[model samples]
Target chain A: MGAHSLLPFTQDRDTAGFFEAAAEGRLVFKACLDCGHALHPPTDHCPRCGGWNTAWKDAKGTGRLHTWTTVMHQIHPDFPAPYTLVVVELDETPEVRLMGRLQGEPELREGMPMEVWFEPLGEGGPVLPQWKPVEA
Target chain B: MTATVIDDELAFAGRDKAAVVGIGQTAFSRDSGRSVLSLATEASLKAIADAGLTVDDIDGIVRCEQDNVRPYSLAAAIGAKNLHYWADTGPGGVAPCMMMGLAMGAVMTGQAKAVLAFRSLNGRSEMRLGGTGRHDAIEVVGGFGSYDEFYLPYGLQSAGQTFALMARRHMLEYGTTAEQLGAVAMACREHANQTPHAQMNGRPMSMDDYLASRMISTPLRMFDFCLESDGACAVVITSAERAKDLAKPPVLIRAVAGGAPQDHRPGMMFPVVSREDMTELGGRQAGAELWRRAGVGPEEMDLAQIYDCFTISVILQLEAYGFCGKGEGGPFAASGALRKGGQLPINTGGGHMSEGYVHGMNHIVQAVRQLRGEADMQIPDAELCMCTGGPLPIGSSVVFRKAA
Candidate 1:
C-alpha cells in the first residue's frame, strides 16, 4: 500500500511548497522574513513577530538528532514494525525541528549528525523527505 | 521556566465548597458488549444511588470531551427533570479530573444542586486508543486538522511511541533507566494484586517479567502501557452541606486546577518534539497552582493516584507535583517509596496501569476510597489524596481531603 491511499498530502498554499520541494529533492522551511525567526509546518502568520510576511526558504537538509524511537509494533498497514522515527534540530536554528523516518540502523543516539534525503512514499508513491546518518 | 506560585487568597476560593459524596464503577473487562450510552447510564445511576439521591436530585451532568456518552442521552436515561448545568471538558485524559471543577462551579454558583461527573468508553471492545487504527485519525475532521499531518505520517501513531519519546528524553537527561520504569509497573502490579476490582488482579509482576516483556516502542515495553479496559466510572459532586447527610462520608474537594504549557495549542501533544525541554509537562505547569489552591503541599498528601495511562506518566507526575525534584523521578520511583506503607503510597487502588482505564475517573474514585479508609490497600489514617489527570503538555489535577 502506498501513502497516497492512507495519508493525505498538503496541496494548500501554506504547505504545498514544502511538499512540492520534497517531491523534487529539495528541502525548504517557513520563517518570518522580517525577524529571521524560523517556523515549521508553515503558518499564515509568524508566531514570533506577528508578521504575515512569511517566506519559504531553502533548507540545508542537515541537522543533529535530538531524539528518536524504534517502533517494534506494527502501527500502520503500509508501514511494518521496526522503523526509526527521528526528531532533528536544523543546523541553522534549534527552533526549526523536523521529524521523519530514520533510514538506517535501529540504533540511535542524541546529537548525531543527520542529513535529509527523499524516498518514495510507501511503495512508489509521492516522494517524501527522510533522515539518515551523515557520513564522515 | 519558573513555576507560578498561586496566590493564596485567590486559590482558596473553591476550597471546601464542594465535595464528592459518591463513587461508582462498572465491571472492567476487555469487552463490555454494551453501548457506551448504556455504560454511562449504568454508572451515573449507581453514583446517584451511592450518594443517596435519585435522578430528580441530579440537576447537572458533566462529561469528558470526545465521549460518545452525551449528557442529553444520559439525562434521558436517568430521567433527570432538569439539567441546570451540562458541560464537557477535553481533550480526553485530562478532562475527567477537570470535570470536578466544572461540577463544583455549577454547584457553588447555584446553577445546580447536584452534578454527576462521569466517563464511559468501550476502549477495548469498540475502540483501542493505544493501537494504530484510531477512528479519529482516519476521519480527520474536527480539531485534528494540521496536527495530524506532522506525526501520523511516520507511523508514530500510538500513545506508546509518543510517550516513549518522552521517556527516552528523560532517560537521556537524568540517566533514567528502563528498570526505573519497571519499578512503576511493579508497584502498580503489587497494588493490583490486592485490589479486588483490578483487571490485573491475581497476576503478579516481577522485575525480570517487566524486562522480558516485548518492546512495543524502544523504551516502553508492553508492561509499561495501561490496560485498554471496557468500563465506566462516575462520581457525584454536591455541596459540602448536602454531603453531611449522604450515604458515604464526603471527600472534600480541596482544590482543582488545570493548565497547559505556555506554548500549548490544541493537538500540539502528538510528538511534543519542539519544546526545548520535552520533560516539562503540563502537569508541572498546573501543579504549584493546584497545591496552593488546595492549601496543602505534597508533604501533607497521604497518597497520590496519578493518571497512569503509562508508567512514565506516574513518574512524571511525581516530579511535576513537587513530590520529588526534576530529574529525580527515576530514583524516587525505584526507591520503593510508592509501595503501600512506604513514604508516599501511590496508585493504591492499582491505578489505570492495573485497575482499569476510565479516562482517569477511577483515580478520583480511588482517592475518595483512600481518604474514607475504605481502599483495599488503605494507608492508615489516610486523610489526604491527590488525583492527577494525564501528563501531557496540558493536564488537570485535584486534591481531596477527609471531611474536617
Candidate 2:
C-alpha cells in the first residue's frame, strides 16, 4: 500500500486530540490533572492514582533513542526499502515513548539524543511524527 | 509502627485437574486449497477419535478469537450435541494455553465434561501473516482502535520489524551475535528434519544458510522468521478421572498461567517499546507462576516447546523462563543447549519455525506427543514438558507431566 493507501486513522473519543495536535505540529500525550502522571496513546483515567481527570499535554519534542530497527525488505509499496524506525523516550516523560521514522543515515547508538518533526502524508492525509539524530 | 497483611492460602485448585487425552493436526502446507472450517473440522474429528470419543461426547469448545471458524460453526459441523461451554481467547499466538486454562476451568466447575481446543487458518494461501497483509491490516491496524496510530503511519507495520528492534538492543547490551540467533534456527530446523509432517521436512538448514539468508529487518534474516503455512491443530481436554478410561496415556495439565507484567501498556503488542525492560517477555511472570503451581522448576523439564515466532523470541524466553540468567540466553543457545542431545531440548517438533505456525496449538500437541512417547523427535523417556505461548505480553505457559 502507498502513503495515500495508508490505513485511515479512526479518530474516536480517546485519540482525536492526539491526531489534532499532531496536525498542528505539536506532539501531545495524556497527563493526569490530578496526579500529573503521563499516559501514552492516552487513557481516560489515571492508572496510578485512579483519577478520572486527564487532559492532553504538549511534549518537548526531544528524546533519547531507546531502540531502533532498519527495514531492508519492502512490506508496503509506498514504504520503500532501507528505512529506519526508532523508539524515542520523550524528554518530558522518560517513561513514555513514541515511534517514528529516522530521517537520515546516521550511525545510531543507544541513548543518542534525537528530536521529533512532523511529515505530512500525500496531499491532505494525516500528519505523522518523524525523528532525526540531534547532537548530545 | 508498621502493619502487615497476610494474603489468602495458596490453593492451586487447577493443578493436575485436567489432562490432554488426544491430539490431531492437518498437514502443514503453503496452500490447503480448502476452507479453514474444513481444516478445523478435520482436525477436531481426528482429535476426538484419537481420544476414543465421538463428536457426541464433546460438551465444550474453545478457540482463538482471531480464528475465522467460530465455535458454533464447528459444533454444527462436528454434530456436537448440547454444548455446555464455549469461549474464545487471545490476540494471537498466546491463545492455545489460555484456551486449555479455560477448558480446565470449565471441567473443574462442572460446566463441561470434555472440551475441544483448536486453531485453523489459511495463513499462507489466503491471509499471509509475514507481511502487512489483509489479515494484519484489518485486525491490528484498521479494525481495532489500537496504538497503531503511532507506528503504522511510519511504515513500522510487520511483526518482524517490531521484533528486530528488540533483537538489536539485545545484541548491544549482551553482545549477542547473528550466529547465536542462527543456532536457534538451525536447531529447530534439525528437529523439523526428523519430523515427517513438518513443513520443512526433508529440507535441512545449516548455520551458513541461516547467516546467508536475506535480511528482512536488520539483525534478523529470513531464516530467523517462522513459516506462513496453512494448517490446523487440535487437542482434547478432560478431567483427570475421565482420562483414565481414554484410548491414550494422559498428559496431565500440571499447571497453566497467563498474564502480563505491571508495566505492560495497553495496545502493547505492537508498540512493546514503552516497557521498563524491552528485552523481557511476559514469560518471566507467567513462568514463575507456572513452576509454582506445577511444583516443578525449569530444570525438571525434559523438553521445552518455547515459542519461536522469531529466533530472538526464543533467546528472550530462555532468560524470561529462567532456563538461564538475564542476558545469558544468547550464550545458552550458542552452547547447543536447544539441540536434541543438549541440556533442555526445545521445539522437538521443529516448532513454528520449521514445523508450521498453527499459532501455538502445535506446541501443545508436540508436548503431548513427547510425553506419550509418540513424537518423531521424542526425548527418551520424557516425563515433564514445558510449553510456552508467544513471547508477547499477556503470554502463557503450561506444564505437562506424564501420569505417575
Candidate 3:
C-alpha cells in the first residue's frame, strides 16, 4: 500500500487588510507595549507580558531566509509540488521571523538574502506577502 | 473547583506548580465521527468527573488541541468559567506537563485556584467527513505549505520521511536494525494490550508484523509511526497540599523544563538531521537539565513515559536521558529490559502509536497513573515516573513522583 499519511486540511483565514497593505509594498509586524517584542505572526495580545496593547509597525522589508522547504507533495489537492516555503528573519527585529513563499524558482539554501513581495490571491482581496531571492 | 472559564478573553498566569486532580479521555479510535469540539467535551467531562469535581469548579483553562481542536471554542463547549489562562500550544505531547508546571507556578504565586490542561483531536472524524488539511491548488501557497516547502520539493515531506531519514542515520551510525525498531513497537504493544483504552489494545505484533507493515517513508515502516485517532485527554493541576484530600493520590510535579536545540528553527533538509544524524541534541540537553533539577537520574525512576511519535524517537530519548550511552540505544532496547516488570518499563500505556494519539498528553496521564498505582499494566511500586514532551522545533520533560 502507498503511504496514506496525509495532513488534515484547514480553512483559509481572511487577510483582506493584509492584502491592502501589501499592495502598497509596506511590510508589517505587531509590537507589544509591555515587552516591545515585534510579533512575527501578528497577534492581538503579547504572549510574554499578557498585554493586549499592540499595533502594526512597518518592517524594513529586508531579511535573510532563515530556512526554507521544497515541497514534493501538497497536503491539499490544489497545491502543486516543489514549492518553497520560507521563514525570513527580519533585520528590523531579531526575534521576528515571518513565513512566506519565494516567488521565483526556489532554491532552499538557508540564509539566502530575500526581499518581500506580494502576490494577489484568492478573491484577490488579500495580496499575500511572498518573497524572492535577492539577485546578485 | 471544577468550573472552567472559557471566554474570548485570553489570559494565563506564568508557569506555576499546580497538582492534577482529574484525568479523563475519550475512546481512542481512528474513524470516530466526533468533531474536535465533541471529543474535547467528552474527555473534559470525564476528567472532571474523575477528579470528583464539577465543571463549575474550574477557574482557569489551558487548551492543548492535539492538532485540531480550537482552544477558544472547546473552552466554551466545556462552559469554562473565570477563564484566566488559555493557549492552544503546539500539537506536541510535552504540552500537558508544561501546563502542569505552569499551573504549579500559578498556584505557588496564588494566581488561580485550579487549572485544567486539556487536549483534543478530531483529525480522523472531522477531516474524513469533509474537511482535511486544505492543500488544494488555492490553499497550498501558504499555511500547509509553510513548513513543507522546505523539504517536499527535495522529497522530504511527511513525518515518516523526516523520521525515516533520522532512523536511517541512526541505523548507519549506531548499527541499529529494523528488528530493534520492531522491539520498540513490540514493547508498546505489550503495554497497549494491557490498557483497554489504548488504540491498539490487545493487538499483538512481532518482528514480522513490524517488518511487514508497508513503508510510509523510507526506513520507517507504517508500524514505526504513531496512530492518528480522534479523542481528547485532560489533567487537572491544583495544589499537592489540597490534592491530599482529593479522590486520587497526588503525583508531585518534581520538575519540568522545555527547550529546543540551537538548530530548532527551520530545521529540515538544511541542518540538524539534514544529513541523518539520529542523535537528538535537544533530547539530551533537556534530559540533563531535568535530571539535575529533579535531583534524580534514569536509574532512580522506576519507569518512563518517553515520547514515541516514532520508535526511533524513543531510542534517541533513551540514550539522551542517560538510560544508556550514545549509539547503544539499539542494544539497550533489545535487552527486552524495558517491558513491564523490566528495569525501565518505558511507555507502559503504549505510546502515541499504540495509545491513542493526543499529541503526547496521554504519556503524561500514563505517568500519573504509574505513580498513582492505577496503571492498567501497573509496574511494581512505581514511585517515580518521568514523562517527555514530543519533539518540537522544541521539547520539554517532567518527573512525577507519587506524593507522599
Candidate 4:
C-alpha cells in the first residue's frame, strides 16, 4: 500500500490530534491528565489510572536511540528496502517510547541523542516522523 | 509484580489427569493441493486410528481460531456419534499447547470422553500469512484488534521486523552477536538433516551458509525465518485411565499454563514501543506455573521443543523460561548445549526453523516422540519434555511426561 493510503483511521477520536499535528509538521503523544503518565498510539482512557481524562501534547522531539533494524528487503511498496527503522525514548517522558524511521545515514550508538523530523509521504501528503542524530 | 506460584495440592488437580495417547500428521509441504477440511479429516482419523480408537470414541474437538477447518466439519467427516464439547482457541501459533489444556479441561469436566486437538492450515496456498493486506481491511479481523493501525503504517508489517528490533536491544545490552543467533539456526538444521520427514532433511546448514545468507531484517537473516508449509497435525487426549488401554504409550499432560503479560497488550506483531523491556515476555509468566504444576524445574526437562519461528525467538525463550539467566542466552546457545547429548536437547524434529511449520503442533508431536523413545535424535531416557507455543509477550507452554 502507498504511504498516503496508510493514514490513520480518521474516525477514531483519540488520534484526531495526531493527524492534525502531523499535517502541521509537529509530532504529538498522549498524556493522562489525571495521572500525568504518557501514552502512545493514542488511547481514550488512562492505562495507569483508568481515567478517561487525557490530553495531547506536542512531543519534545528529542530522545536517545534505544535500538533499530533496517529493512534489507522491501515488503511494502511505499517503504523501500535498506531504510532504517528505530525505537526511541521520548525526552519529555523517557518511559514512553516511539517508533519511526531514520531520515539519513548517521552513526548509531546505544543511548546516542536523536530528534524527530518530518518526511512527507508525497507532495502535499501526510507527513511521517523520522528520527536522525543530533549534530555534534 | 511477584510471580504467582501454584500450590502442590492445586497443581495436582489437572496433573497427570489426561494423556496424549496418539499423534498423527500429514506430510508437510509448500502446497498440499487438498482442501483444509480434507487435511483436517486425514490427520484426525489417523490420530484416532493411531490411538486404536474409532471416530465414535472422539466426543470432542479443539482447534486454533485461525484454523480454516472448523471443528464441526471435522466432527461430521469423522462421523463422530456424539460431539459433546469443542472449542476454537486463540490468536495464532500460541494455540497448539493451549488447545491441549482446553481438551484436558473438557475431559476433566466430563464434557467429553476423548478430545481431538488439531491445527490444520494451507499456510502457503490458501492463507499466505505473510501476504500483503491492510490490518483494518477486514470487517472483523479476529483477535488483531485496532492495534494494527498503530504500526502497520511505519512498515512494521511482519513478525521478522518486530523480532529484529527486540534482538537488537538484546545485542546492545548483552553484547550478543549475530554469530550466537546463527548457532540456533545451525543446530536446528543439523537435527533436520537426520529427520526423515523434515522438508529440509537433505539440505544441511553450516555456520558459513548462515553467514552468507541474505538479511531479511537487520540481524535476522533469511535462515532465521521458518518455512511456510501446508500441513495438519492432531493429537488425541483421553483420561489417564482410558489411555492405559490405548495403542501407543500415553504421554501424560503434566502441566499447562498460558497468560498475557501484565500490560496485556495484543502482542504478536503490534507496536511494542510502550514496553519497558522489549525482551520481556509472558513465557516466564506461563513458565513459572508450568514448572510448579509439573513439580519439576528447567533442569528436570530432558528435552525442550521451544518454539523457533525465528532464531532470536529461541534465544529469548531459553532465557525467559529460566533455562539460563537473562542476557546469557547468546553464550548459552553458542555453547552447543541445545544439540543432541548436550545440556538440553531442543527441537529434536528440527523445529519450525527446519521442520515444516505446523505452527507448534510439530513441536508437541516431537515431544511425544522423544518421551516415547522413538525420535530420530532420541535423547536417552527422555521422561520429561517441555513444548512452548510462540514466545511472544502473550504465549503458552506445556510439560509432557512419559506414562509410568
Candidate 5:
C-alpha cells in the first residue's frame, strides 16, 4: 500500500452484500432471481427482464483478461504513476466484467487466464479485488 | 438492442424545419482571466449580432447543464426582455448538438422564435476535466450512485484512462498501429495550423512528435488528449422561414438524434468497461437514426465535425457514422482521408484536439462555418456537415445542410 489511502467506498442497499462478501474472501455478484441474469456492480433490478428480485451469486475467482491499460500518469495521490489496470470477464459469466489493479509484471494478452485475490486496505479500509496471472 | 426508439412522426418533425443562422465563439486559451458569465455574455451577444438581430429579438436560450453560466443570468446580461423558452442539456462534451436539437424542437413547436444555444466554461484554470482537480470521487448511497465505485479505487480515474482501454482493445482486435492513432492527432494539428484562431495553430505536430509525446495512458499520448481551454461558443437558431432574412445563409437542421446503447451504464466512462463490446459506441444507433431522418447517407456529407475529445473519439465516430465499416477506423484514419482535400475532411476548425475543448460546442460552430463557406480550411462548396456529440455511451448527433 502507498502512503495515501484508497478512495472511500460507500455501500448502499444494493452493494452492501458485495462488500460484505469481499470481507470473507468470496467474490459475489447480484443475479436476477427471475431470469438468472448476472449484474456486475450490482443493480436493484434486471435490465433485461425488469425483475426487481435478485440474489447474490459467488464468482469462481477465475477470469480472462478482456482489456487492460498501464496508467502512466498519476491522476490521484493515492494511485502513484506506472500502475496497470485490467478489466476481466468472469469465467462463469463472460459478459459480466469487473475492473481492478493487476499485480506483478506479466506480459498480458487478451483472453489470458487470471485469478482474483483480495487485498485488505490496511485497518478499517475496504477489501478490494485484485488480479494476477494464474500460476503455471 | 437499439438504445433509442425513433417515433416516426416526431423524428421527421424537425427535419429542415429549423436552421442555425449565426455562430460565435470566444478566443481559445489556457486561461481567460474572466468569469464564465462574461464569456457566455460575449459569445451570446456576438451570435445574436451575427444573425443580424438585436438582443431584444432573442426570446429563448438553451445551454449545457454543466456550463457555469445559466439561462437567466445570460438573458439578464444580454438585456433580453422576456424569454419564451429556456432549457439545458448535458454531461458536458455530449450536449452541443443535443442543445441545438432542443433549440430546434423549441423553435419548431413555436415556443420561441429565435433561440440562443451556448456553452461556456473555464475548463483549464478552474475544473480541469482530465486532471484530478474536480474531486473524482462520488457519493454512492445518497440516491446518486454511479459507476465510479468500481474503478476509482484502482486508479482508473480520468476519462483518458477509460478511453485508453477502448483504444487498446481496438488495436488488439484490428491491428491498429500507434501511427494510425498518430494520423488523427496530426490531421487535426494540420487543420489547426491553417486555422488562425486555433490554440495549436502555430504549433504543428508530426507523427514522430506524436509518437514521442509522453503517454498519459498506455496507448494514449499527451497529444492524443484534447486541449483543456477556457472559452465559450454560441449559435442562433430560428425557423427556416426566418433564416432566409438573416445576415448569413441558413444551415438547415436536417436531423438530430441522441441515445445510448441498451447496456449503457449510468455514469459515463467507468460503466463502459462493463459494456459487451468496448470498441463500439452509442454512435452506432444514433448515427443510423441521424441518416434515416435526414434522408441522407454518410456519403452525402461534405465534411464531418466528429467530436475529438481524444484522437480515439474521432476514430470511433468515423466507424460509428458509417464513414467506414466496423474495425476499420484505424486504417481509415491512416489513409490520409480526414485531411483537407481528402474524403470526408473532419474538424475543419481544428476540433477539440487542436482548436479547443468547448465541450463539442466548437464542433457545432465549425460545422456552421463550413456550411457557410467561411471556414479557414473550408471544403469548397461544403453543403452538408455532420456534427456528433459524444462518442460516449450516451450521445447525440446532428446533420446540417446548406439551404438550397
Candidate 6:
C-alpha cells in the first residue's frame, strides 16, 4: 500500500516545467524582456509589466531558508505523510524563490541553518536538490 | 508611499457599496471522498440553488482552481451558458473577489446579468497536499513556475517555513512572543466553537495548548497553523436590480479590491514591516482602498471572516486592513476582540483554522450567511460584513451589507 502525504495539492500540466528543472538540480526562472522581472511557475507574460517578452535563465542555487512546514497531512496522492515543505530564498538572484521539502528529518527550526543537496534518484531521473539541516 | 497605490486616498476611505448577497458551501473534512470536480460542482450548484436560480441563470463564472479543477470544465458542468465572463484568480483565496470584479464589470458594461464564483480543492485524493522541500520539484504555473524555481536548489522548501522566518524576524525585532501567536489561534478557536461544520468542533484551545502543539517551525506551532481540508465553496453575484428577485435578500458588493506589491524582489515578501521594501505594501494599500471605496470604518463592520491559513497571516491582515497599527497586531489579536459577539465577530463559522480549509471561499460564504442573519453563531443585526483571503501577494477582499 502507498503511504500518504500530510498536506496534499495538485498542479496543472502548465506548471510542470518548474518541477522538471528542480529535479535536475538546476534553478530555472522566466525572465521578461519588458520590465525585467524573473517569473516563477513559468508564465507567458511578465506579471509586473504585462508583457510577454520572456525567456529562461537558470540561477546559481544559493539562498536562505526563508520559512518551512512539516505537513502532518498529505497534499497529494503520490507522497507519504508528514513531509517537510520549505520555501528558500535564492542567493544568486533575489527574484527566484522555490518551495519543496527537506530531504529527511534532521532537526528543524526557524532561522536554523540550511543548505541544498542534489540527491541522485535511484529510479533514473535527474538529480533532485532538497533542503536539509546545515551545520555551522 | 512608494507609488500611486500608496498615495491614493480615494481607495482608503471606509465606506463602499459592494455587499454579499448569496452564500453556498459544501461540508468540509480531512477526507471528503469526492473528486475535486465533484466537490466544486456540488458547492457551485448549492450556491446557485441557495440564490434561487439554476446554473443557466448565471451568465458568468469565476474560479480559483488547481490542476484537478478546470475553469472551462466547471462552467460546462454547472451548465453556465454564454460564460464569456470568467476569471481564474490565484495566490489562493481571491477567487470570489476576482469573480466579484468580473460580475461588476458585466453589470457595469451590460455584458452579463449575474455571476457565480467558486474555489475548491481535494486534499484527500487527486491532489498534492503541500509545497515542501521534500518534493524534488514542483510544476510551474503563471508566476510560481517561472521565477520560483530560482530558490529550489537552496534549503527554502515551503510557505510555512518562509513565514516561520518572518515570525522569527518579527519576534527578534519587536519582542513578539509565540504565546501572542497562540492568542490569535485561541481567538480563532473561540469563534470556531460555535460553528457546526468546523473541523475542530468542540475542540477548545488555550495558549498553553497552542504552545504544546507539535512545532512545525519555531514561532509557528501546530495550533498556530490551519488544517488542510478537502472541500469546495461558492458565492453568487447579481446586479442589485436583479438581486431583489433572489431567495435571500441582496447583499450589495459595496467595494472589492486586491493587489501584490512589487518589492519583495526575491522572497514571498515576509516581514512586511521589517523589510519596509516598496513591494511588500500591496496588502495595506488594498485594505486602504477597500475602506475608502466602501465608505465605512473598520469598526463599523458587523463581522469579519478574515482568512486564517495561519495565525501569522491573521496578524498581518490586522495591520494591512488597519484593524490595528503595525506592531500592535499581536496585542490587538490577543484582546479576543474578534471572538463571536466581540468587537468584530470574525470567522464565526470557525474560519480556516477551526473549519476545514476550502481555500478561502468559505469565508465569503460565511460572510453572506452572517449578513443574512443565518450564521450558526450569528451576530445580532449584522448589517455589514467583511471577508478576505488574507496576506497573499495576490489576494482579494469584499464587504457586504443587508439589502435596503
Going through the candidates in order, their DockQ values are 0.45, 0.50, 0.06, 0.44, 0.54, 0.12
How close is each model in CA RMSD to the real structure? 2.8, 2.7, 9.8, 3.0, 2.1, 6.6
In model 1, how large is the Cα lDDT of residue A72? 86
Task: List the lowest-lDDT window of 10 residues for candidate 4 chain A.
Answer: A1-10
Order of quality (TM-score): 5, 2, 1, 4, 6, 3
Find the 10 residues in a row with the least total lDDT in model 3 chain A.
A1-10
| Model 1 ranges with Cα > 4 A deviation | A1-4, A11-17, A46-52, A103-105, A122-126, B1-10, B134-146, B262-266
- What TM-score does structure 3 among the candidates reach? 0.71
Residue B104: error of model 5 in Å? 0.7
DockQ: which candidate is best? 5
Cα lDDT of model 6 by residue, A1-136, tens digit: 1221221111334345544665667756667878777665456667578787887677665566655555453434444445566656666554655554654444655555456666543344334455555666
What is the C-alpha lDDT profile of model 3 across B1-404, one tens digit per residue? 24545332222222113467788888878767767678778888887788877777776677654446665576688887666655555545667757766677766666656777777776465543111354433323223324442233223345554555567667756789988888889999989999888889878888888899975544567788778777778888887777877888777887776666643434322234421133574667677767766778889989998888889888888887788898888888888967987778999988887987777878878888888888888999888888888764556788888876
Please, what are the lDDT tens digits per residue for candidate 1 over residues B1-404? Answer: 24557566766878988999988889999999999988988888898998899989998999988699889889998799878789989778989889989998999889989999999999988878876554432432112245556567666677778888888889998999999999999999999999998999999999999999998888889999999989999999999999999999899998999967655533546737776677778887688788878778998888888889988888888988899999998899899989997778888988888999888888898899888888888889999898898877587999998998
Give the alpha carbon lDDT tens digit for every residue of B87-117 in model 6. 6666565555656766676665666666777
lDDT of 5 by residue, B1-404 (tens): 24756579887888899999988889989999999999999999899999999888899999988888889999998899978799989777788889888899888888999999999999998888886674434322222366565677777778899899999999898988889888998889999999999999999888889999998888899999999999999999999999999899999999998768757765656778888888878888788888999999999898999899888888888988899998899899999999998898988878899999999999999999989899898899999999999777586899999999
> In candidate 1, which residue pairs get closer than 3 Å at backbone N, Cα or C atoms, i.e. clash?
none
Instruction: State the weakest 10-residue window (summed lDDT) of model 5 chain B.
Output: B135-144
lDDT of 4 by residue, A1-136 (tens): 2344455443456566776687788988888989988776567677678888988888888999888888886776666677777788988886667777753334588788889888676676556676778888
In angstroms, give how far residue B388 of model 3 lies from its true place.
Answer: 0.7
**What residue runs in model 3 are displaced by over 4 Å at the alpha carbon?**
A1-136, B1-17, B65-72, B127-134, B138-147, B267-271, B274-278
Top candidate when judged by TM-score against the true structure:
5
Give the whole-model CA lDDT for all candidates, comma-separated. Answer: 0.83, 0.87, 0.67, 0.83, 0.86, 0.65
Runs with alpha carbons beyond 4 Å of true place in candidate 4: A1-4, A103-107, A119-127, B1-11, B131-144, B262-268
TM-score, every prediction: 0.93, 0.95, 0.71, 0.93, 0.96, 0.74
lDDT of 5 by residue, A33-56 (tens): 898888876788888788889899
- Candidate 2 per-residue lDDT, tens place, A1-136, comes to 2344564374767777877888889988888999898886578888788889999998889999988888888787667777888889999887688887754344788988889888777666677777788854
